[model samples]
Target: MRRSERSMRPRRAGPVGRGDRGYVTAEAAVVIPTLVALAGLLVWGLMAAAAQIRCVDAARAGARAAARSESGADVVRVTRAAAPEGAEVRVTRGGGLVRVRVTVARPRFPVTLTAEAAALDEATVGGGGR
Candidate 1:
């Protein structure tokens, strides 16, 4: 056999197909960033969800306060205080209902959260122990 041909021959039982050698490293190199990005997205989504829930809770609190005839300014302040940082709260009364709307800015990301709640009037619901 010529030297070139012999050298080109596949060696028997060599390291050619030994359990996908170098595959793990290559796959890790390709998939690690994607996984990291997914993790980041998951964290951001969780944060956004939490912000929304908090906004809803704040709205509920404000609506309840406003329904009690509390000062509108105080209700708004309370709502803003209850919400997460960088949040804007708006309270309005119309048609015997107190509506609270909140908008929150996400940290380290470009996102805004909005939530609204209406206060349940005691008069409308059999009165508040009046």
Candidate 2:
């Protein structure tokens, strides 16, 4: 057997397979960033969902307070306490009903969420008697 021919032949006892170089490194290079980005998106989605729930709760809270004939300032404080930071609260009353709206923007994102709730004015409901 010639030296050149023997060098080209597959070695039965070798640890490195023939033509199998850099495969692990290449795969990691492509998969690492993709996994990281997917994880980031999942976290962002959870945050958005939480913020949405807060908006709904805040609106409901404000509506209940208004329905009880609480002062406007007190209602605002109750709604803001249940709402996310930097939220805007709007209350409207007419036709024996009180409506409350809560709006907020997600942190570090360009998304906005809003929720509204309504309740009958306590004074108008069954003549406000137990």
Evaluated with TM-score, which candidate comes out highest?
2
Give the Cα lDDT of each candidate: 0.83, 0.91
Per-residue CA lDDT of candidate 1, range 1-130, in tens?
Answer: 8899999998878576797889989999989999999999999889778878988999888888888878878998989888988788888777768898988765634777788989865445565356
lDDT for position 32 in model 1:
97
Candidate 2 at residue 36, lDDT?
A: 100
Model 2: per-residue lDDT, tens digit, 1-130? Answer: 9999999999777575646788889999999999999999999899878988998999999999999999999999999999988999999999999999998865635688889999999988886568
Q: List the residue pairs that clash in candidate 1.
A: none
Number of backbone clashes in candidate 2: 0
Taking the candidates one at a time, how many backbone clashes does each contain?
A: 0, 0
> Best-fitting candidate, measured by lDDT?
2
Q: Which ten residues in a row have the lowest lDDT in candidate 2?
A: 104-113
The estimated TM-scores of all candidates read: 0.74, 0.80
